[model samples]
Target chain A: MERILISGPADPRLDDFRDLNHSDSRPDLPGGKGLVVAEGPLVVGRLLESRFPVRAIVGFKNKLDSFFASFQAENSGVDLSGIPIYEVTRETLATVAGFDMHRGLLATADRVVEDSVASVLEGARTVVVLEGVGDHENIGSMFRNAAGMGVDAILFGNGCADPLYRRVVRVSMGHVLRLPFAHLEGSYTTWQRSLEELSQAGFHLVSLTPDPAAVHLEDALKGRDKVALLVGAEGPGLTEHAMRATDVRARIPMAPGTDSLNLATSAAIAFYERDRSQRT
Target chain B: MERILISGPADPRLDDFRDLNHSDSRPDLPGGKGLVVAEGPLVVGRLLESRFPVRAIVGFKNKLDSFFASFQAENSGVDLSGIPIYEVTRETLATVAGFDMHRGLLATADRVVEDSVASVLEGARTVVVLEGVGDHENIGSMFRNAAGMGVDAILFGNGCADPLYRRVVRVSMGHVLRLPFAHLEGSYTTWQRSLEELSQAGFHLVSLTPDPAAVHLEDALKGRDKVALLVGAEGPGLTEHAMRATDVRARIPMAPGTDSLNLATSAAIAFYERDRSQRT
Candidate 1:
């Protein structure tokens, strides 16, 4: 990687890293260059390994060196000849970022086209389908949990947030960059029809709800070859139509008065149960 | 309940809520009133049902009216005659809260004494033991999970944050006020001694870790009559000393190369698995 020395925050070459917190979330910015921004070495490393195309990087020399070392460790063979890593003073880096980035480094990647639901679902055993889960942190944590629990892909129905958003990337610890996700086909009403593909692919669509009449999550997944756990926002769970589409209305039984768990935690439990059921 | 009409935000009675976002996190504030703040109708309703002694209530007339109606519906039979419900305009409520509490309602309650570790463990089928889980939001979510999953109590080992802090209270959705919890007796080294009591009470101490060599989470809990699912913070999972204190180190299996799950989500999974094991 070539080291492009930076004197201050104003260099045009460093525009990809400037006020980065603003750029990643706003797709309507100039030229629609809303690059997917990954912060720190941990997330930036994931960004490098992801399908997203790297634009450039800004960091102190030490972090840049370690990133290269980690790349060498992975032996990813990703060509670095054209990727310029701009080295700057810590002060200049923070000023450019508009926040004191303790990680002292960042990288920007041009957003790639999202994969289709079918491509993400290829050969998958379990996937988590989300609806109305528009919170960035919730989406991020859901991706992180989905990755750890070995769910194959994540598909969004209606009212889902952009997974590539900067906060989502940071909160997911970069797992959002690694996890395969796609928005479900069609609008909310027709969204149910799109799930027909998963059903055709032999997925047992399990919609998680707070209804006591629903089967326990464990029993609901029993003997299913492939499963898609559908979850919704915290206050208002899956819409009536969304719930009606699922093969099973499943629940993690709760004490009498408590409301539903936070959407991510609920999804994590469902994912864990899915993994346990398959293994056992 | 007496409905007191407050003219503005400056009333001395409203000081409990003034600059609340700052005061709740700062225990050293003058007068030393660390009041438990319940914002929003959902949480305020939980507060009305909890054991915390309500100091007073403040909100617009509509929300206040609904709260009394809810109190009557619950039919707690507790005398509400002495508790004054203060009424104010939206502007006054915002000024009093230092920022608009979109919850449109607020209630103050005196902080109650915590239960002893022994009392918390009594009759607990499962309890979540947290160490170095200092983040307020994590603490709150842990409480919520523990409560919903029917985990009898939460016992903090060390380096944990105040569960009653405002952000925690808000994040837990008022579960902090309802759940029973205690800081383990004594300091870090001596805290291990408290585990002896749980052992004597027939509780299995299962420490959660990221080590793949450990038993899978489900396998680790089989045949255990009562369980304490111990979890540490996100990074630097349970200290070696903490891990060694458990009867077994258990892991929620992860995909290759992922770090530990978020502390609250990790504990929630364990609680869910524990719920599953107990039933089937």
Candidate 2:
């Protein structure tokens, strides 16, 4: 990594790191360059190790130095011959970013072409299919939980948010960068039909619902060879069209009169149950 | 409920709902009245159903009218004759609250004395004991998940945040108000010693950790009659003293190289597994 001393917040070299708090013009937003951003040293390290092409790194000198040393120690073989590591003071970094980034560091990566649903499903035993989960934090937590729980891929259905969005990356602890995810392509009304491909790939599509009539999650997943847990947004769960396409409707057996679990937590329980069932 | 029309934000009757966004002087914060606030209609309804004594209600006319109608419909025998429901325009409500409360309504309640840990554990078949889980969002999610998963109570150990914090109340979707919880009375270093009481009450104290060597959660929780799941903060898990005091440390077998699941998600998974174990 080449260390470059950058003094002014207005430097042309820092454009990728500028005005990040601006909703419309932030480099990572859709209206801007549509780049991916990883905040904090831990997430930035994950970005460095991911397949995405890194553009630049900007941070306070001391934070960058410690991060680089630990990153190299963990990944000795990483070749960063051309990546510019911009070393700036706290004031310059905060001014350039248009906010006090308490995390103190950020890295930008160009978004790569995503995988196809079938491509992401390859060599997978457990996967998560999301519908209408537009919240960044929920999507990020989904990726993190999926990675931790050993779910192999994530397929986004209708009304899902961009998985590469900056906050999603930060909230997922950068697991969104490492995890395999692909958007299911089609119109909103017809996108669920693509789920049949998952069925053809020998997946037991389990729609997670709060309906008491649904089978318990453990029983639904007990002996399945390959499972795809379908989750939806918090307030309105999976659409009837989406649920009808799945093989079975399963639930976590929540207490009566209580609201359903948060979407990510619900998916995580399914993932955990899927793993537990396999182990036994 | 007496529906009183308040035209001015400066009216003294709105004191309990004033300056809600200020960190120091918010009615719910330590420097102010230390009252419990319930935002949104559903949460306010929960507050009405809870044991917390209602102080006042303030909201826009339409939101308040519909909420009160449904609340009364749901609880036919409950009396609200003495509670004052302040009717104000959107601007007045926003001005009084010091923020644009998108939820459109708020309710103030006097903080009731919390139950003792021994009393909360009296008939609890499943409970969660939290340690050092200081984040408000995580604590709120813990309560919500505990309620949905049928956990009977929550016991707060050392370093935990107040469960009645405004953000916790909102995030828990009012479950924090409905769920029975108690603070474990002890100094920071000696709190883990209180685990003996749980054991004496015939409850299995299971500490949830990410350590690979620990028993799998399913195996650890299977066949336990009464279970108390111990959860800690995100990064540094349970302190050694806390884990040392438990009967067994259990793990949700995670994929290698990934970070542990979020604290609340981990507890929810444990709760799900505990329920699954007892069914068979």
Candidate 3:
């Protein structure tokens, strides 16, 4: 890897790293020359392993050396002979990013096109489908939980936030980048068809709700081989049509009259329960 | 309840209800009257049932009326004859609270003195001890999880946040008001003494961690008649001294190299495991 020294903030080579806090929002603009950014050492490492094309690496000297050493250790055949690593002081890096701290490192990569829903669901056993979960933090936490609990893939339905959004990426601790997810774009009929496909593939469509009339989660998930857990936003919850479409309306036994748990937390528990039942 | 019509923001009777967003922080100030505040209809309803003395209720006319009807239904003998129920437009309520869109209702109540740790643990089988958890949202969720998982009480250790903070109250969905909890204020010595007391009362002290070497959570809780689950904040986790002080260190099975689960979520899973084991 080639090392470059950047002493000034206005250097054109640093353009991809400029005003990153805001540029993260317009990643699709400027003929889609936008960079997919990974912050902190851990996330940066994940970015390196992802399918996204690496553009450049920027960090302090120590971080750059440490990252390069680890990269070399992980990949022996990969020739990084032409890759440029820009080294700058922490203060300069923070200024270039328009933030107070840089979390020690940052990397820019070309955004890869997400796989289609059909591709994401290929050979999947358990999956999560989300609707109207517009909160980025909630979305990120949900993906992290899904990854941790061994959910195979995530599918986003209508009214969802951008998973590639910076806050979501950060909150998810970069699990959004690693997890296999795809958008389901189109009308409600299209969503219904996609869900029907999963159902045809023998996935039990479990709609998670707080409705007392729904079967208990443990009882509902019994003997299921393939399952798709459908979760909605916290307050309004799943739309009536979506709930009606599911095979089973399952609920975690919550204390009576309490507001439903945070969408992500509820989903995590549901995933954990499913994993436990399957293991048993 | 006496329906007081306060048409203006300058009314003295509504003083306790002013600037609620910042009141919990500066409790020493006049506006920060140390009054316990409950927002939204559900939480306000719980505040009414709590031991805290209701000081006043300020909200929209319909909301106030509905609350009054519920109060009358639940306690026919209690005279709310003179307790002021201020009628205001939603816009006016928002202005007085220093925010837009009041969750349709707000109530002020005197903070009730919680029972001592000893009193809270009387005849209790399980309790949660928290240390250095200064986040109100985490504390609130902990209380809610404790209630749902049948944990008996919550004991706050050093550096813990105030459970009555408005965000905590809102996040807990009024469970903080319904559940029993107390502060352990003396010192490390006092905290240790409390644990010893709990041990004498037949509770097992189990500290939750992500350490791979620790016993599995399910294995640790098996056959335990009484357990005290200790949890700490997300990043720093349980202090070394605290970890050593516990009877056993138990770990949730996590994917290697992943960040630990959120504090509240981790606590909930531990509580869930304990409940599941006890049932068998």
DockQ ranking, best first: 2, 1, 3
Fraction of true inter-chain Cα contacts (below 8 Å) kept per model?
Answer: 0.83, 0.95, 0.17
lDDT of 2 by residue, B94-114 (tens): 888888887788999998877
How many angstroms is residue B93 displaced in model 2 relative to the true structure, after the best TM-score fit? Answer: 1.6
TM-score of 1: 0.95
Q: Model 3: what is its DockQ?
A: 0.38
**Model 2 segments beyond 4 Å from truth?**
A22-30, B22-30
The candidates score, on chain A by TM-score, as follows 0.95, 0.96, 0.92
Name the best candidate (by lDDT): 2
Relative to the true structure, candidate 3 has a C-alpha RMSD (angstroms) of 3.5
Q: What is the TM-score of chain B alone in each candidate?
A: 0.94, 0.96, 0.93
Which of candidates 1 and 3 reaches a greater DockQ?
1
> Candidate 3, residues B116-170: lDDT per residue as tens digits?
8889888778889998899998999998888876888998877788888888988
Error of 3 at B135 (Å): 1.4
lDDT of 1 by residue, A1-280 (tens): 5689999988888888777667786577564456798888888888878888888888888888887787767865666668778999888888887888778778899887889888998989899888888899999988889998899899999888878889999999999989888988777777877888889999999999989999999999887899999998878888988888889999999987786798889999998888888887
Q: What is the TM-score of each candidate against the true structure?
A: 0.95, 0.96, 0.87
Residues A1-280, candidate 3, lDDT per residue (tens digit)? 5789999777888887888867766455653345678888878777777787778888898888887788788767655555578888888877788875547688787778789888888888889999888898999898788887788899988888778877787788888888899976756545655677778778899999988899888888887999999998889888877877789999877655555667888888888778778877
Model 1 pairs in collision: none
